[model samples]
Target: MFMRRSHDFTFTGWHMAGVVCLFFGTIISVNVYMAYQAVHSWSGLVVENTYVASQQFNGKVEEAKHLAASGLSGTLTVGAGMIRYRMVDAADRPVDADELTVRFKRPVGDHQDFELLLSPVGSGVHEARREVLPGHWIVEVTGLKSGERILHHSKRIAVTGPAS
Candidate 1:
């Protein structure tokens, strides 16, 4: 002969409600977190006016092509509170410019963006003294002579050490 035991446990509506709440709560919590990160990490605006920028895109492209065909290039070095640029032509001869400027921009935000005007240091070399923060940056260098653009260069770099 055998004896059987009875238990009081049961799956009720309250239990179903709790499971549903937990599943949806997790999903909603994750979505809110992702939304917050997306909003704070990067500003969505690249230019102030999208239509105006689009209208000038072709002209800018042509300018870039012309600048590239000129065979004029520059080497940029940034570190230790100094920014140096040396411009050269196709023949590897030193090139001179009337004015030169460098723009340092953060990839994600504009808060740290800044521009520095470089002073000529003889032999086609330009120098600027500034402590650049160590991080990923988009650097833009421009050279002009007689109010006309002579050199335009942009590059991405990572600085892992201190700015000093």
Candidate 2:
């Protein structure tokens, strides 16, 4: 029994250094990977001309306020690769415009952004067929009359499941 010997696994500086390296290395690697993905997927600028946009910002706000004051609003519905846009005015009647410009953007990635020119179906209603890939999409529709942007409405819609 006295000859039965067991080796002790002693903790040392090398073990400590290895643990520290592993703990910090994983964090650093994850951070670097996330940063790279964001940088590659992100557009460099949200606004082309910051100064010009800032200068005209107030005017745009006023325009929006005026439109709201007029009780101009819209309802947007999306389903099955289709979009139904209905515009209404203060009297709760459908508003009519010649054409509409629809912008579809994916919130996460940059590859699936697209634009569509929708045609009017009836007074205050427009329909368009757009291949809405299954994902989170930011839908923006601007009612245009005589080639001028009049009513701007935006909504976020999620199309679930794998890309169809």
Cα error of candidate 2 at position 63, Å: 1.9
Could you tell me which residue pairs clash in candidate 2? none
lDDT of 1 at 147: 100
**Model 1: how far residue 52 lies from native, Å:** 0.4
Residue-wise C-alpha lDDT for candidate 1, range 80-131, written one tens digit per residue: 8889999999998999899999999999978889999999998899998899
Tell me the TM-score of each prediction against the true structure: 0.91, 0.78
Task: Supply the TM-score for candidate 2.
Answer: 0.78
lDDT of 2: 0.82
Q: Model 2, 13-116: lDDT tens per residue?
A: 99999999999999999999999998987776677899999999999999888766767788887777677788998788998888887898877666779998
Model 2 residue runs over 4 Å out of place are: 1-12, 161-164
Worst 10 residues of 1 by lDDT: 1-10
TM-score of 1: 0.91
* Candidate-wise lDDT, in order: 0.93, 0.82
